[model samples]
Target: MSDIGRTSAVALVGVRGTLVEVEAHLTSQLPTFSIIGLPDTSLGEARERVRSAATVADCPLPSRRITVNLTPASVPKRGSGFDLAIAMAVLAAAGTAPGADRRTVYVGELGLDGRVRPVLGIIPVVLAARDAGVDRVVLPVGNLAEAQAVPGVTLTGVDSLRSAAIDAGADLPAGFVEPVLLPVPSDDTPPPLELADVVGNATGVRAVITAAAGGHHVLLLGPPGAGKTMLAERLPALLPDLDTDAALEVAAVRSVAGHGVRSWTHRPPWEAPHHSASAAALIGGGSAQLRPGAVSRATRGVLFLDEATEFPRVVLDALRQPLEAGRITVHRAGGSAEFPARCQLVLAANPCPCGNAGTVGGPACTCPPSAVRRYLGRLSGPLLDRIDIRVAVARVTTGTLRASDGTAPTTDAARRSIGDARERMRSRLRGTGWTTNADVTGAWLRSDGRAAPGASDLLDRALDLGTLTMRGWDRVMRLAWTIADLDGDDRPDRRHVERALALRMAL
Candidate 1:
């Protein structure tokens, strides 16, 4: 009888589940290794790479017929992350390696030249492994930093198949060395853009501060030279640092997208896609596999759309779903993939084609009222309804320029205020599962019944006069809460409500 044995391991096809098992068997037949599974080209080729890697590592190759079967073979495997796993299984079956059943997951792409290459989605993969009671994971050296981001998992980085084999006791290479900690990248702090740099637009600055505090979406309609882009860039300065969970979410998106996850500590991402961005680029759609688009990458951060009106209607409409659901689902021939997209939207657009629709100092407007209406008409009412703040930015005047002294607080001051406001809101809505005012539903807003007496009357009048939709009414109430929180008030008062309404109707 031929001596036969099997070793087990796992591989991640997508972000969905933990590794599928790869069973390696050696039998009495012509020397040949065959891989049986629904594997893509990259995965199927792992057989040849593993053989060469073992040879380079000076490990003995089985002279008998070798066959590898990936169990639950119905599911597809797409990457070379299975190379190390397959190699380990082969060694274990030959009685060359030890610790084959201690729940150790391996993930890495093997280069034909025996180098371990980085693979995508390492963060999520390691996290899944850690959660599934897997005590340790062996990943490509380049991916060690990302794998380290996940706590509770003992991560070992391998440089080549030979190094990995020596660690597993498969074959003792000439110079076997212990695993070294991957060098961590030095932290680079982004220079802060101060609110004091803005010449005027005190009201606009305050509105942005409120948006940061409550996670509200804002639209800025202004003529040329109104500093719309400048203001949008400064919004991140007012935002609080990303929390631990939010930081991981942002890092995961970047990791899978092949962008290295630097520091997830306090950085807030800011994505400013050009107006020419396609629908797929904005909302994430591709042929076979759906990759994350700009909106998805902007999760838990800011998505600034400058010249928002210039974008196609289709692209603009795609944002509505993610904006409401905090995530987007992209369906394709293979399957659907969902990406987190909870972001603070900041849209800046010129008032009209002439860029002088309502400016005080500008050339005479030749476009008719119909054209102006059509220009703004591109933005649907439903979309406008979702935006909580609509402020009109005016061109800076001579007086405003003179007042651009350092008298006002800097960006640090505004950031502190935003932090304080967020803490207050989080405490109040702690048990309610609401993170910010923008996340509170209309029912919750009304149920609270904490609105000021005169403010309720004003809100009722707006609803009665058709000035506010049901959604708009809720957003106004949310804004009132944010304003009150900023002013250190325990409850929203009439002045806060009035100010909120004024900011909403600024455009």
Candidate 2:
């Protein structure tokens, strides 16, 4: 026997996958098995599973000193997906096969009864393999669908360890039982949300449309039952579908989060975490392995925070960096992982803690001035400054409710308008590496070449009066450009700038 064998595997770091080389060696010493190369708790336990599975599959390990080493010892390895690779390498060292195929990557969990079990994040693993130009991959049959999503590679799915060992040139028994895999439950299909469901909130609807068109952040201050949540939920409906690259990014994030990636969706995702969620849950971190949080999962979509004031100040403040940089990095004792955070933010809050301070003809304002100020102060000035649109949604009155006809704005109409505006933005920003006005740099927007002539008079006045910070003024300029795009104008004029200013100062 050669007493040496090698194969390939993958190690997951956040949503990224790094190729790993698995090597096995046998010697004439005490009979034992060991795995090295910074294997974590779950990965270290793969020894017992692989040994038992190999014995059950009629290809037992040699009764001599056995050692397996995952090359690139610096990278921390987690999860049990390396079981198949580890088993194949050891069996090949025992002369079961000439040698494990170095060009083939193996990923799957082995059961004591010899069944090959599926592992999470198979999509990212296959993607990494494809990127590395690997010729073939052997994984659990249960994950074949998601693994097939990545092209340019041959995939071989195995239902049992016996089947895999036999295919690897082992002289094993012919009778083999395939593991029974349960059918994946279908998603509960729900009717798509519509913009017309919201009644008597024209200003709120308009703000959502502008935000969708420009990919801008929004804040909604209103009393209860004013349709603030409705407006925020419907914003995604007005936006266009995600492109191929974005859709793949979304699927990769979901796979890393342990969500199903069988079928991908072009529509952007929507994440609405409760106010009581921990900071680690909203951001991305964990004690053992770093995981993607709500913000990362909401990438290329909307992150709506309902009852914004009820959340802890520190947790809410954690969003500032991601909002500016379009990505978030989480640090832990093990290592740091970066997650995508390029999503629109929508904050919905009551005018006061009492929820009736500004209701019309319905309740009295019992909250004192100091109490109201303290309640609203939960939203820090810096955070609010990042929000481009601040609209106050008034309570629906008898007149507004009675006049609510079906002629109100429809999602289809708003979508068409937003699509046209986005096309204009793409044309204008052809080589800027930016797709939306909100992503444009303030310096670039202020440059003479790209600046809209005679549109910054109001912004300059506001800056001189110290009413708007430099950041706020830049956001206003972006909003004005979006308005001009919606109107199909060559550039923003005084009217568009004025409308943008009003939206910023509405509350």
Candidate 3:
């Protein structure tokens, strides 16, 4: 047989960019192994691990000069995920390792003693391979569940390189067992805080419901313990379960970030980053290769910012682009990387330095009006205009707090109502390519002018009164359509427009 041999393919695990392919070649020469293609430190070390794993698996090491090339050499590859693929490719090219089928993509990290270890982002990588017409995939035994989540792809799990080599038509090693799929466990529990426990903040509750129904951005101004965080946490529960495409998108992001969903159920994701989080952490970035950040991880979900005013102005301001474009671009020395950041933003902040600034009960306000203005002024007008609903939360009274005699509606009840409203909105925007009111542009909103007659007149009046800017008018009109949709109306009416305007002015 000819000594010159090559085996090459790609592996991808993220939607932020294209798939990554790995290629390997072997030739008769000095016994040296080299890996190319912009591999990071971890990937560069795969040469040693692959050789030891092959030896332990009873596969003869190639006594030749081996060169492995990962295509698109400019893109930096991280993690040990390429270990198994690289090793298999080397062995196949050396005419030793088993199962050299080009239709199957192998992904896993191999230990020196021949054990296969799980790696992150297997789900998206396998899905990408399947979409690219690859018929089968072999992954670490531990990652089979995640890989199996994607249908129509033949998934095989291997515990050691020995079994893989044997399956590939090589000599079998002793004490090798076929890998089996592990059963994934399920944990179903209700959310911690129910809307009924929120006591009396009827206006706040209404705003929360409306925001949830239309996937609108919300801002909550209240004291430290005014239930703002509680309301924000429950918003995710109010959102309808994610559809298939959205679920896949969310799963892909989590996988790339080395996290996985506990269950395959398509519940909306919730992400609440602390006030001290950096701009890079909120958006996404790293040294060599960029990774998904909180916003990208929370795509098609909710991102709650607590203690909003405490965050650095620069960090908070970085959100403007994503808020407007539904995506974030991280510029680097080599090039720019983009990530999806389309999410419902809920910001909770204290009213003033003392946090007791407009509340009826509490210590006397010591903060000057200038301090209060400065605190609130940190929020830019453009950012505030992007937010659809703004409500001030107030403390609940003792009687209202104690009156929860199981008579009030549970979160499930609220969720059902919100779910119905969301379905209605989705039906209305089926072919419009819009998922929520906040996503609708000015042109689209104006196109349906005659559809909602009084909406235009009311918006014009608000603009004339200087109560709303041009951008604010469009956002408020969008909110009006959302309100109408929540009320099961075909189009926004004068009442819906008035309610939306009222919510906007409440800030």
Candidate 4:
């Protein structure tokens, strides 16, 4: 008699999950099991896991030669998510009904004791199945909440290998109790922190707010005590909530990186890489599986770099492409994967080598002028020019600290203004596929988004006088458009361009 059956699972290629066909065959010979296809070490180990799980679940295997193949045999399968699927295929080949196995997608790790353990990247797997017109997905009970994030797909939860077999129409053991899925807890999202918490430095506070309003990159230069880090942390709170599609993409990235998502109502993420981070960590790279890095983690959110000068120039230069294109492509010998990295950049640095060189009341700096110049020069001109807002934060005064608490704009107030600005930009850019003022290109701005006649004259004079390069002129125009949107102006004027120029070149 012929003995062969097939099931399905998913393999995460980068952040995108592709459906994989799991087929099992049993031959009459001295019992030996082997798994084929280009599976990594973790997936190759699933054979022993599936065997032990089946034995514990009261399914005795007849001594026969068994071979499993994960088809699309050229694709690299990395994780152990195929364990349950492999077990079900084996059971079907052993004479269980194969109808359910043909209709559903199976993904979960099976333990030796018949327990089904949670695996990473569940969202992308279920999403891929649903998109492929496979309506039913049977995954671990622990993953049901995550599966709920994507609608339009039927989800089945199983806690052990025995349950999966029963779902596949295998006969249940006598007196076996059906597994109950536990209810996931609901955790309240705490209120976002306020911009009013910072003591002083109005320019620093304003620069952050403007950065949020325009989706512009920012550079904060000051001493250690100037509230640079605090300002960067609060920028996300003042920004608008992501739309449905953007939120799903963001959640998918987090899932692929092995972080579980309890809910999709998550805020835009924040990543603050230390000065010692490597280029691969900042951008994305790996020998086994090319993973998303800090930039991809900070997609549609903020990436703060404190002590920016301490980072090696090579590592820092790696950001230029993502900053321009809003995505990064990592090429490995196995393959290449592109990750979305459209993050708002924030870099905080000190004024000089000693940090006290230019301070008013601080002690004299010992470093020579040449040393100070070389220290700050690490931030290349091209990279610094890409940053739209540059603000120097001065030391907070005693009088400023003694003043009332609500001295500056609150994050709530700033959030309201920023939301209005974003809405305005969206309305203006409805058919342009650009959501924010920052995404507007230099060519597009020049062609269709010209400033008022008065503002245009001022900008032309600045360009002719060599105060602005061609790129600088474009960035200034982008900033002016953002300022105009924030103020509800129909078009930018000279005043807005002046403010934009001041905020533009402070490297």
Candidate 5:
């Protein structure tokens, strides 16, 4: 005699998920088990784990040939989250448990002790199930809170294979012991970094405000201890909170990167990769499973690259694509995956290797001119051109440090200004499918969002004189619009254009 059982599962590729069918076939032959449908190394090992777990859970497989297949077979599936579905399918085919509902998606890794352990990317997996119109999901108990973050889905959290089988209408032996659920670790958010803590560097602070206001990238060049890092860190505080869709997207990225997502928050993320990070680490690639990199993690937030010049030139140059496209696609031998990377890039670097070459009145420079040029040359022209704001942060004098007149900008004040500016941008770009000045194209800016009459004369001159590329002209126009919005102007005027030009040429 022969029997067939089927269930559903989700395969995550980057932040997206694809629904996969788990089908098991039982036949009266010598006892053997095999899994097919392009399973990866970790997924292929599910055979042993499922067998051991089913036995310990008192749901031993029938003494018959078993063939488990994940279809459509062309799609490459990775991870051990498929264990539960495979086990349930085998048991159902053996007539031990009732067949699983095809509408319900199963997602969780199984241990040898019959425990169903949580796996990464549950958020995206559940999200995929929701997107695929599968409203019910059976996952590990540990991920209940995370799965609850996504609405419109009925969740059934199981602690063990036996409990899952019982939930699936299996006739198990009596003496059911209630399973103990482990408490999910709380997602504790640290206190917000205050903008008021920065002592000096008014220009640096203003540059950060412009960045937060328009979602523009910034480059901060200065000596050490000039408050560059402080300014960069506080930019997020000056921006508004993320909306529901954005928060969910960010949570999905975190979940896929193995950073547990207990709940979603409106606060944007911040990623600061070290200089020693490889290209794969920054751009997102791996041999086993393609993972999200720092750029993807910083989607809808800030990506701070401190000591920017210390990074490898290739690694620095790799950011151009994500900055331009607002998304990153990692190609591997297995396949390709895309991740959202629309982030505000904040780069802080010393003027030279010795860190005192550009200071007004600090230690004398010891590094040679060639060394300084080489250090700064690591930042390619193409990469630098993509940055919208370039400001030189000079060392703060002792007099300036002590001359606080109680007029320093606070996070609340900056946030209000940025929020108002962003609102204005959204209004202006209502039907354009864009919400920030930086996202507007040159054609749109020239035709619809043009500056006041005769306001762009200097910009025209610069463009004609070969000092600025077309890309630079567009960037300056965007910066000018952001400045005008911050000042409550109907449109950019001469003053705004001049200020934007000065900021762009500050380095």
Candidate 6:
């Protein structure tokens, strides 16, 4: 005779979770134990950990043929999160208690001493559980805060297998649940970086503002000391706070990366990768498990690529799809996982090998013309076309530096302006799934007739003159809308289109 016990669990396919059922079977046969169904090495070792944990917690497993299976066998299971569920299922099958409980989720790694350890991706797993109609979740005490961040769900944090089994209505050793507090720094928070230090490059600063307002990508080209890096650094300060849904998404990415939320600010993330970063480091691919790359971490944020010309062509080209689709899928021999990557791409580069091309120091540029072509050629036209704002930053002169512009707005003021513009966009785009001008499709703009007087004629002239591709034309229109929103215009007109074209064509 054989007895069966069941419970539910979760596995992170990417930044999302796929529900998995844990089934435990016990039979009166030759004493042995095994785990079937597709499981990575991490999940395979869970058996030893769970058995030892159950024994230490005074709920010993029967010395018989014991088997555990993760249903939907074709789906590859990774991580050690299934430990609790497996242990509970086995105990129930042994007639120890009602261990294999339903209407809930069990996700935690088991230790040799029966301690329930925290695992990666608590937020996404909990979000998936809520979506799957599971209301209660049993997580490690350390993951309580992140699990609590998801509303409308009952959370029970346990310190060990003993506590978890008891809470699940199992007849096991009773113990008090020790609440694990999230880590907090002892030092006071430091003051924020100021944006006003970046003098000169007023055009670049304005372009940053426009990009912040619409979530459009930007490309900056200039010699050194032109404030390219400084401008990019200040962009996050200009961006407004993220809403609940966006914060949750960002937190999910952070959790999967094993990076705790050091400072839980709603500010958009900024990731500036070195030019030598590999395709997998920037775009995310691995041997067995796919990971979140710089692009994925920059979701709803800025991904600044400095010294853009030095990066490998293939690595840079990998960004094209995610830019268009707002997500990326990493397909390996084992499986594929899709991660959201709707980040604003910011590319900064020098004009030539000498970093002085096309500037006042142009006469001193030592690189040959062939070398220059080879340098700038790395950025393909197709990739550059997706960028909405392309500006040439120039080094500031002494005279410009001495003059004080006290009336210039600081980061807070610029953020207020961006926030107001975003609000206006949301009002117009309500129920449309687009919150900013950059995300609005050209077809929607044309169909809704938001383009103003003499706009099409100007766009048509640019297209005929071979200055803009079909994609570039649409991007220009979107940038124009962002500009109009900043200037408090309800519709984009010829002036906005002209300025947008100027920014886009300067490259």
lDDT of 4 by residue, 1-507 (tens): 449978888888777777888888999987978899999888899889988988888885657888999988987898788998888888888886455565688999888888888777788788889887888999998888877888899999888888888777778763343443334444433357888898777777878888898889999988768788888888889878888788878877777776665536558877888999999999989987788999998899888999998888888889999999999999998787888899999999988888876777767778899988888888888888788898887778787677635587888888998899888899998998999888998888778898887786766887899877787788889999998888899889998888888777543
Best by TM-score: 5
* Per-residue lDDT over 1-507 for candidate 1, one digit per residue giving the tens place of the 0 to 100 score: 243334334544334445667677888789998888777777788888988877777775688788888877887666777788888878877777765533678777766667777777777677668767888888888888776877887988888877777677754755543343334444433456888887788777877889999999999999888888888888887888887878877877766666655634457888899999998889887764467888988888899999898887778888988999998988877767778899999999988888888888667677789888878877778888889999999888887777765455578888888889999999999898788999988888777736866676788898999988888888899999999999999889889988999999998
Residues 217-267, candidate 3: write the lDDT tens digits: 999998878889888887887888788877877777766666543524487
lDDT winner among the candidates? 5
lDDT of 3: 0.77
lDDT of 1: 0.79
* Per-model TM-score on C-alpha atoms: 0.91, 0.95, 0.91, 0.91, 0.96, 0.95
lDDT of 6 by residue, 1-507 (tens): 999988888878888987888888999999777888899998999879988988888887899999998888887889898898888778778877584465778989888888898887888888898999998889898888767778888888889888877876776657654544445434332235566676765788788889999999999999987889888888877888889889888888877876543423476777888999999999888867788999998999889999999998888999999999999999889889999899999999999988988888335888899999999999988899899999999877775566635434688888888989998999999999998888988788778836886886777887899877888888999999988999999998989988888888776
Q: What pairs collide in candidate 6?
A: none
On a 0 to 1 TM-score scale, where does candidate 2 land against the true structure?
0.95
RMSD, one per candidate, in order? 3.1, 2.1, 3.2, 3.1, 2.0, 2.4
lDDT, ranked from best to worst: 5, 2, 6, 4, 1, 3
Higher-TM-score candidate among 3 and 6? 6
lDDT of each: 0.79, 0.86, 0.77, 0.83, 0.89, 0.84
Model 5 clashing-pair count: 0
Badly placed stretches (over 4 Å) of model 2 are 173-176, 180-190, 402-404
Identify the runs in model 4 with alpha carbons over 4 angstroms from their true place: 174-191, 399-406, 458-467
lDDT of 5 at 201: 79
Query: RMSD of candidate 6 to the true fold?
Result: 2.4
Which whole-number lDDT from 0 to 100 does residue 209 have in model 5?
A: 92
Which 10 consecutive positions of candidate 4 have the poorest summed lDDT? 180-189
Q: Which residue pairs in candidate 4 collide?
A: none
Instruction: Please give the range of 10 consecutive residues that has the lowest summed lDDT in model 2.
Output: 182-191
Model 6 residue 361 distance off true place after TM-score fit, in angstroms = 5.4
